[model samples]
Target chain A: MNSSHLSLGDSEIRIRMLSQVYSASYLTRKKEREEKSKLLEQLYVHDVYDRIASDFEEQQYQPWPKVKDFLLGLESGSLVADVGCGNGHYLNVNPNISVIGVDRSFNLLRAAESRVPGVNCRADCVALPFRDNQFDAVLFIGVMHHLVSSERQVKALLELSRILRPGGTILLYTWAYEQQKRKFNGQDLLVPRYPSVGEDNPHCNCHRPTTKSSGDQLLTLPNQSQLSVLDKLERIFVRPFNLFINLFKLNSHGDSIETGESKDYINSVPSTQSDTLDDKSINLITKCSNSIYSNTLSHSDYHYDSMILVPKEFRVREFPASSLFSVSKVLNGKVSVHKRDCVSHSTNPARSRDDRFYHVFKRGELENLIKSSKSNLVVSKCYYTSGYWCATITKNTL
Target chain B: MKILTHNMLTSNIIKSVKDGYPLKIAATEVQEVDVDFNPEFIQRLLAKLNWSVICEAITQLDATKDIELPENLTDEVKEDEDMLRKIHHVLLEVEVIEGKLICPETGREFPINKGIPNMLLNDEEV
Candidate 1:
């Protein structure tokens, strides 16, 4: 079932494996998240783009395949959005595209706006700041699913549906789930997975070698468990704080809540982004969610959520919206199994985070430094690349 | 120098960020001076720059050229001495005389006066 086109040399293999764990684990807490975001900013300017540029050099430095004429369409001033535009990878991918990239991570927005020339910033997906049907097309690309709860997932979709004008098309890509449960090198756990060629799959061939586990059939990982078993964080210690976070929306456009603008959202004057707590509630919510994410894999984990976009006027059916976003839309791009192959043969390989380079932060820490500061920063998720957490935190006024 | 160029440069980024593949420019005063392209260098630098970023910087500095970048190096910008010389002029030779370089993370400004950039950190920047 492997493609002839699927051969990875060596270094690419390590980078891909590293990229996986970072995306899955890094953003769950605060400390390492900050370091990773800033590190990713450095990688683009120094390491990645130049090398990646060679691969796409003939392709005009665009990371996506087959992109010339399709991107030319963007030149017409068609308004586009780069949702979760980490460091504006895709927004910056085609300089000709008339696009605006947005994300929840403020650090990345700063680095992205620095690298990219003319991208604009809006507030949040849970509640967008534009009028209804304002864009010619919207691009979800490699973002969505970072929201942890099913309600937040639904909230994001409903908001997207509302903003998309009639006939406005949206594009997205993300992780797809696999059906055949597999283990690594005869072990009981799975490290990572692509959607199994299920009985319903139209694209994949069900040809992988697998094993049976606890009366259930499973695929065998080459060496280690593909899916990670996370640390068990003490939730009771973090419960009350979680409530405060949900009650307050730093996102601002949601309703009467603070706009996350003025002197509140990192205004650096009377209040800071984190100090907007008239109620110490937001910190509680952040601590608890961080604890939960740090804990073992379960339903509440952000990994299991879905992110799909339906027109504001249309009702979706048949597909579980969660399943739809994870498998259908999110997994649309060409996957490089290069990094996975590296782990299969490494002298010492790890499936979970080898480091925190791929993580992004929650809303709180992003606000801490920015509340009263106005240094031209905005936040957005980046296209999934590098073994690092990517963000596009740039300033709107600058 | 543009802060954008500064962000990419770390003492170790060149050595460990990748291999010693490309020389990391840890420039103290990389002024983005306005210069006519040395056609040969633009051709040579074409291979070195992230084309999208290069084009973007070009757009920021000059937008009159049609947004045409070399799709494939062989078919695109040639290995002309003139082109490289021009690019060498634009990328390396240009002077960012008026602006200041800010820390990529903190937005702390470091002034560049008379072609000499001051990356000296005050207690606040540190």
Candidate 2:
């Protein structure tokens, strides 16, 4: 993973070649600035899956129908390699075609072995164990983005082309940065993960002080600005005393609050704090008081203990298909880049939350990517299905 | 790994290993599993294969006892069903369960365990 091992000549050429795919400015963005921490980022990306391999496998039993259809369309007995094949979900897509699944996670591969006994290889996509021009078709589904840099992504694509026979087909699935349902702050983000508490607590209710869910309770508090001079003067002296009384009331009725029967008491406490504060200050005070109350009550039979956020990070990159135009240029205009709008196929809600960066494709982005690459690979068919931008490209027979 | 997969792999991925192709197979265990025959698929696959390299690999694995393949594929041989089956057997059915794929130029041996070939190179090699 270190650049020092690469020969100076090889590294120079690779950097030059990759520069054609990524502009100098684009390359410097987060990855280079944080070069010292790159190893940590990689560990986060790989270790998160290792930790959650079981939960991830459970949510991925259903394969994307479009991908299944593509596999079925291939000629019988075709040798296919599914790079980044998590749990071998696509291995059984067609009994006629032979599939060799490869992944970096051993735990995920173990799950795949239980489902499909043979043909799973533990390998990285950057340097696959398979021979050159070996497969009739290759799949790079949900795999490229995991590579931390554009250079690695290009290298992976080249590796795919290296193994693929001339005139062979490649089925690629990548998360798009642009989607209809969600918005992103940047192309690179470290998505936060929250532990899942099954249907017993369907709402995932936790004490999120900033969320709008508690707006009603916040509105019940009094605004200090609304008080007259005499009232304000009296309130300053009474505020501390009221806070103590409220804390006593909360402890006395902790059981009632746990059962959702003490809304009246909870609302009353905020009203006392609101008397000496403006609306904004009242909100701050209410948040502080709630955290204190929740902390103390949580120790005693509260159901919110499971809501603690897990200290794990999943690093993800969202690529704007348009940005790949430069990369397509490096491929001699044989590859084209496109943007497509599609729903994300990730079933794990924790992985798809706002904190997680996703590059949801806008409609036609995938096709544009292939076309813009100007590579020999032509888009034979491209479409959106099962919440993914799916495209099948074939190397033109020269 | 099947000989067909071996036919497509090269150890030249690392700059140090030049001409790392046509790896000499030293298989300790070879298994022949039945696979559905598709004449058209084999015919298409034959064009992409390096016949001499494959022949050399077959010989190295000591699997030439039952199968006798010509040095080069010809038009008439393409029409021969028996020849095609033999070719198919050597390519897809013959699996090297345990062995080493020695690089022709560098003489570096990549180990194969339980039918999976580990083509990963060292850090400096990459």
Candidate 3:
């Protein structure tokens, strides 16, 4: 036996052994990730809504005209299922139809039960308890964005399809990336739901931002371009600290928590309306500014037993150095500002635990998702309405 | 939950179950809320619902009240307001305030509290 050949054989065995170890670690990491994602989904999406149910009712979200019109158009005695009927806002929109509301949050369902008694149930949208081909119409309004992944969203649509009768209509709504007041850095981001802030500032009388002209918008996202020189310098100094924290995470956990991908459709989508600041938004901001801080607690403050991990996709991209310096300084003291990168830094734990996870859809993303599922459904109508991508899909009768 | 809502519910969300239709009900608390009777609505639901499943659920409720739907829903039953009213009462009025929906195939139980059947599956259950 040649000595070199023997050494090569030994190295080959070592490499195989190393790969086995690597794969094992990878599997564990994946498992850990899945567990974390599930926990995050529960805490942020499920628990947050439960905590804020009554407050959500007080907001008195009037059904969107489009949704109301759709409901009104349905034949009398139509069997309709409102998939995420928070407080049953649209449950009894039309008394002519028999509508049942379903939601994951029991508190919200309880609230719904009070209004539209015995119509709402606590059920996940992805796994609805309904039998196949049972309904004339299904209303999936303002619910699709809460799901974390594309796969989950597709699963939900498929579930909806399964329950819908042949030729049944499904009215779907999700937050659009091209909104006026709020700016999303990516498809996935958190929208803070100030449950207590509304309760604390009862005099403020902040209404849920609706499609109507009289709608009152609250909580404008802090403009990145308005950062002061001091803030920018602080961010610059904070960058290395973030890096150090990530490096420490890498060393201890063998995985980096930082997200890198940022740009895709932020600036590409054209705004249908001008960027003028509405008066109702400003008034609500001024009135509720004081109570916002005390009410919005960080996730760590909640103190769950297990380790909580913000899924990588749910993370907002860190402000790049170039964009940081280039931002025009237009500071408005009346408005309260909150950082978008709430997941990255320990020092800036300004993020509201009430901030629900939202995967704001790109223009055609909703349509593409339905099409890709290969379900027997067609997008009969889809349009952007009041900062949401609204679509009416029909299940194939043939 | 109303028997009408229960008629559409299934336990097939559980991965182990192939078909979980017509879940068995065990009612601990039940109420009969007054809803406006609509024969047309009852007729529409009858077209979509499995008539036997509705009968099975109503029987499972164990209500002392004598609310009997036809053994088999016929077109004449659809036209009969008296029969339609019975279905209307069973479907819309009689509410299961507290109960458990037992999966037919797997015998897994889902709790119904405050008149809401929680069909949400846990991570392991799915």
Candidate 4:
């Protein structure tokens, strides 16, 4: 056969046909979809922040003590940059050092400006305007988790490293998915925004309207008094079942010793918030109602009133702490993702749904991130305080 | 935004811009505010600064007369209290109230209004 004719043989034709079927257009569309999703996620984050700006500002009145301590430790007259400086509470913490605050929200920047005029700027954390190596100290407290994607989180850290001078200190804080106090579902969550009575319902004390059945609303009430005799009986059966599940979990996992310890820690805490068992029992009852109470109550009614107070519009992303390991494998030894609690069992009815997406950090996630970035940052101190994983890292002089 | 901060900032954060550093400054209004003079802080900062870039930035602002810094740091210069104060003034006191930071590579202009530089880029730029 001639060389040209042989080249167009059966295998070549088949390969050509396969290439034609899955061509450049398919790959391009996939890329476009990814870009669109990222854009949508960014918009969602910004929209939620803008909507909750006022209430969020109110909630962030006090800077966490550990963050304050980090700020106070900076040398007098040192230049400091507070990335995601919500309401500029930390900017005003020390007058000795010059702190320039940057945040994505204009309203939050305005709030910060009101506290310390001319020191606040509206800027995204990913692209700060300040020159490289400008800041002697940089603060990324409660900010890293807000960057939904691992790529953005790493990019932000690199950007931070770029802006900080070698030997300069960086203080970082983020919510830990492995906290002893709280539990969560998936890392990415859309937490509900419960409106105050005046905002959602002007005439009544209850934020939600009372148009639903009184019996439905009664069951949803967190108070024990509102629980019907049937719910009380269900709770009795569900509690032991929850303990059994806990025991099962302990037996299955090698790390059950630590889980048992945290369970005990939760049990010892006397606050109403510590009644995580009740949350588990309630969820169990809701789940097993078909088999346990087939004739007693309708399953649909149990779910309907439970989420009445949850606003449909507002949602926040919760990122899983475990995902950090995949994002930066070099951090594997330093950080460990621990399952502390389940979201459905949260004592706070508002928090039960895990509406907020939290990228909870393991204890040393920040240190690992810095290390993985290969930046000059060396972890000077790392510890958990005030329900946050905080670390103070200093840029190393190499 | 202080010229000191301007000195460190670059518009190259976007993927399209390769060499975003040394952004040309077009300042309509410049202000000099009195900050506490700390020689020690200035000395520490000098090590991190790009002296040649700072000099070029000073020329762009036409404020070379206001602040004079040497091109290189020597042991004597570090101890010179006068030079440290001058460096301190140039770094912290000279604020660009209104200006446009033009990216060297992409020619993208980031506006600075009321001393806050808006470094945010469009999605395409990102």
Candidate 5:
């Protein structure tokens, strides 16, 4: 699916906001719960990964040494499965062993195909396509946290056990709730990802907005005395990628960039729910954007072409008029970048549009899920390493 | 999809379906690529593979390239270098560039595009 479908119109946004929380009566029904969970999975985990696959790979990702060492130690010609193998980097960790990697996102699988051709496929963790007792070992890293619920986490563990040979083992890794850099208020959180929207620096181009105005320029943000606040807002929203530099300043300088009420907006606790964008500053931006969008309705030329700056697949994506308008406000004074310590703030994307869902596992959470699944997969080694909760579970021969 | 990977796939995940082993392959594009022939690796993997499934996949992919083998691995065949090399060729060298892995019991077809089988089922199917 292209990003066009994800561009929320006024009515759709309201509907989405209303449906964010399930009513107690609605939660009582099993079918509704299933539907809601599926929606959450699509909106947060599956779709976000697909959207960010290319940008995700561009960032330098060094293979975890412990995971690589485990793969290197495997016997030659051993059939291994790397479930949730993003970019398929581990497929060639040991040339002697054969590893068939699988992932949920087709785009990610495509990326993996580019790197390690003919070794990866598209498959879900909970419902794998392999037969019973198929693999000698399985690598299930950074996958369980995206399952969305405890039931799914347990279900995925059971599925891994089913495909593993009796004497084989599985190497699992997940994000830890207790982290040294970031403090999470709850187990579930949505982390932001900043994909370079266009080139590294949009200001490097000649169209870089300056006080010196010329009629020959492609864009004209002149200081026309008669122009209303909304008119100036439209021009800013038109070239919204420029707003990132200012957002970058806000993040680097901390509270210095914003002042007074805007500083309070920056200090306020970030909302945990992905759908809830009701922060005081965000509402103001949305209102400004919606107004500009309505005014531009009569004049088609004034419409912001987000396609010029964003990739074809991400054109008019989560950052439609509503979110784009907010970018201008964010640049104006209000800082809305969620204080996410888990991911490097250096590359944090606009939190309003590109939040990635994660369900951080607590201490013993992985063990509890395995035990509750009633599988013969016993935890061989469990420990915390480099701010992640990791475990190695072996299927019992008996 | 390689014959080695296909042998271990099943449609047993489908509702009410059991014994989904030996998925039928309808290959549109088949490519034979060179791989280092290791007789020992072939012999070691022979114990884990189902002989008939490999034969079935070979026939389905290209009937002209079929080579008959016994239902189970014999001591003589395991030791024969020529036979092991042929097994290695069929297992690793031959790849289905584009195809569909059809579930034998349910006729559920999983498409293989750019040589990677998309085994993901719809939410309702799961």
Candidate 6:
């Protein structure tokens, strides 16, 4: 389970894309799931929320006008879906909104469930088990594009449509075709709206007016297209967290996310269907994770370095390559949670490789991806990297 | 193989347009292969499927009773493998007997017949 951080703006986009989906964990055997839960409890939202609220405490995210205008127009008390709702970050940060947080990560949901208490947290997005027309509005924030294909993406969107009361909007924030390439934790997956891939401005530290009021000094955000995408996503998944401040109330005063040290979920909860992450899987994960780690841990990447068995015990061994290539073991890395959850304790030698990750292609290479994936019916607007901006197409157009 | 599974798979070429996955399946050669049902394997496959699409596909074949999902871990679900076996029949047992899978995003079509889908694209698609 990788808790990769996405840009706050893109977070809105990515969240919208998947709020309707659940983690893949619900589909696994009982024993494997429990182990994953233990690892996840460590990352529960109760913890991440407090940290984010504190870290970004200096600067709050004001709901964008487009999203605000849309929410304000909705029937005052409507049901909304918050896809990839991480610790109810959007809810606590914003105001006057209510949403059901749906995410694929257990640790994330634990935090969301705890932070927003009473909210539902199901796993997996691929096949949601909900009946038709169950919700009034489906809003996605920063998570849809991860679905990886048009057929699946369309099916997901259609599922959102099935669950929605007609006229309800699905909010979305996927990687625009022109946006830079994205990575989850460290794996590259031609994704949209990833963490700051090629952004020159992390923060301008400016302020703006939320449709209701003025004088809120917030970070000068990214472009309008990015903001507008979040607005459009409400048509698809959950309303922006900022849009419904009431629904995502938080306990802010450092309440332990866990209910008094219970590792009970440690053994039975199903984890999201991410790649099998045994040591070998982790080892394989490292090879495809990101190329930069190749240098520092060239030696540690090979040896029978580590063993990870919770999701199902698997050994991490060094994969070999050619002689001329200097790099012997092809895989050597660690899956980290914001790097703060360090794992140097393992007998394995290859330490965390966060700093090593870099953009796969220069501006030029990424640009080519965008240009190539483009077609007549699809209008893709890219930003940084040149990858194809993926959007589901209608049968009429296809 | 049923044309259903053919529609969802695209070859894993990681490069070129993302459309050519599991290779698209164009029609004309559709077949209903007879194979033994393995409920355990079907359950495992179900564990790995894009369920929504698979369900949509199964409906296209025989929209009989609503998909019979287990209400609980009943003997019907656990021991009788028929439920799983049918799922297997739909997912793996069936082939693109014929037809192509077109990328909704891209108009590229991969034709199939006799269970083998011809996903070969012109030099340009590559």
Docking band of candidate 4 = acceptable
In the range A268-330, model 6's lDDT, one tens digit per residue, is 122232311222332233345335433221111111101111111122211111111212122
Instruction: Check candidate 5 and list the clashing pairs.
Output: A194-A349
Instruction: TM-score each candidate.
Output: 0.31, 0.55, 0.70, 0.58, 0.66, 0.30
User: For model 3, what is the alpha-carbon lDDT of residue A294?
Assistant: 26
Encode model 3's per-residue lDDT on B36-125: one tens digit a residue. Answer: 887887787688777988887877776724677778788988999888888888888888899899999999999999999989898877
Task: Write model 2 residue lDDT over A1-398, tens digit each, in one string.
Answer: 57666675796667665655444343344233234233322454556666666765443234654577889998866889998887778877887677888776667766765565446666668777657667899987876545544335445666777778789989986653322222222233333343331223221211111112111111111122212422542343223222211111112212322233223121111112211223343234334433433322111121111221111122121221112112232223443322210112133433322222223333344443343334567777654432344567787776
lDDT of each: 0.33, 0.53, 0.65, 0.55, 0.62, 0.34
Provide DockQ values for all models, in the order shown.
0.04, 0.23, 0.72, 0.32, 0.50, 0.01
Residues A115-176 of candidate 5: C-alpha lDDT, one tens digit per residue:
76677778888888888897899998888777765556766888999999999999998876
lDDT of 4 by residue, B1-126 (tens): 666666567776778877588889888888877878877767766665677887788887865455666777788988998887877777777877778889988889888777666777787787
Native-referenced Cα lDDT, model 3? 0.65
Candidate 1 displacement at residue A295 in angstroms: 19
- DockQ winner: 3
Candidate 3 residue-wise lDDT, A1-398, digit = tens: 34455455596766666556655654565465346455557865888878777776666455666688999999887889999887787888887788999998899899889887777788888888888888999998878877765556767899999999999999997876555454333445545444334333222222232222311222333333324532653354334323211111122221110111122112222225444233344234323431332221111111111232222222223322122121111223343433433223223333344556666665556665676566898888766555677788999997
Question: Where does candidate 2 chain A have its weakest 10-residue lDDT segment?
Answer: A205-214
lDDT of 4 by residue, A1-398 (tens): 34565455678666655555444443454355336435534544555555556764443244565577777887766788899887778877876677888887666666665666556666778777667777889998777766654446656887788889888888887764343323333344333334331332222211111112211111121223213422543343323222211101112211211122233221122223331233343234333322422332111111111111111121222122112112111223332322222222234543222223345453334444555455677777665543455667788777
Name the candidate that leads on lDDT. Answer: 3
Q: Candidate 1 at B28: error in angstroms?
A: 26
Task: Judging by lDDT, tell me the better candidate of 1 and 6.
Answer: 6
Model 2, range B1-126, lDDT digits (tens) per residue?
777767766777767765677878888888777877878778866776678877877777666555678877899888899989988888777777788888888888888776666665665667
User: Which run of 10 residues does model 5 chain B get worst, by summed lDDT?
Assistant: B63-72
Flag regions of model 5 displaced more than 4 Å.
Answer: A1-28, A196-352, B67-71
By DockQ, is 2 or 5 better?
5
Q: By TM-score, who's the top model here? A: 3
Instruction: Output the worst ten-in-a-row residue range by lDDT, candidate 5 chain A.
Output: A203-212
Regions of candidate 3 where Cα sits further than 4 Å from its true position: A1-33, A195-351
**TM-score of chain B only, all predictions?**
0.45, 0.93, 0.94, 0.91, 0.92, 0.62
For all candidates, the clash counts are: 84, 43, 0, 22, 1, 100
